[model samples]
Target: MYAAVEETVQARLILSPHRSVRLRTVLSYLPEDPFAVSMAFPAEFSLDEAEDERSAEDIVWVFARQLLSSGLELPAGLGDVHVRPTVGRRTMVELRAPEGTALLRFDTTDLRRFLWRSRLLVPEGEEHLHLDADRALAQLLG
Candidate 1:
């Protein structure tokens, strides 16, 4: 059900060294927080589409790590901070930020909800999706 969605924005790929390496187009929406990331990768990475969804958990982890390593834009006040959900095992994500050389941590269930609400989960075999309204990515330019 978690299909990757694509759109264009001002996000510059920093970790990427080449111009032609665009396998995944990640979209992160954090208008209020400026740090929460809802990274969407190819459908092959989502366990939801697998016949044995539980077996595909490791693939999800690999994808998450690979995607995070590609580097997305981070706002100020997030020095040494990172937020990511761990594969199929995580119900909550670790929200970490640095303050005076020390890392502050908070476990939250919000990221999962954000990611779900950001994308529309169409049932399988649906060929057309008439999207008449905008999604979470609309907040990027606003």
Candidate 2:
């Protein structure tokens, strides 16, 4: 059995080929769109703990695989996905592309609930981490 953490709702943006600048410009122009035009996570995905020491790189790789396999389309010929995990009170997962980087924050509470329901983890008390998916996406595109 693998030790799994709660799964959160993550948003991402698929960049156009060498169009990171254009994408950011368009996002800047459209300020009213709630749904950020970036990468988005599909319904099914999970992260499993590594057998060795838990490094930040390990975590990012796990997250990148989940995001890529979550039915989100990427730009043509894009390879070697780079992800940076911003560790803090609010953990931000940053996906780096040739043009720019997309950031995703985890909804700790909702993810916990989902994990508990999925039997991935035992339910403790109520704790919450509100992840702003839209804002993160917007920032990514911007």
Error of 2 at 79 (Å): 11
TM-score for each candidate, following the candidate numbering: 0.21, 0.25
lDDT tens per residue, model 1, 63-103: 23222322222222233434333333232122232212211
Cα lDDT computed for each candidate against the true fold = 0.31, 0.32
Report the number of the highest-TM-score candidate. 2
Off by over 4 Å in 2: 1-89, 120-142
Alpha carbon lDDT at 29, candidate 2: 9
Candidate 2 per-residue lDDT over residues 1-142, each given as its tens digit: 3233333344333334333211111111011221112233421221223323433321233222233222122221135343233334223334554544554444334333333343322222211122356876889999
Q: Which window of 10 residues has the lowest lDDT sum in candidate 1?
A: 99-108
RMSD of each: 16.5, 17.8
Candidate 2 lowest-lDDT run of ten:
22-31
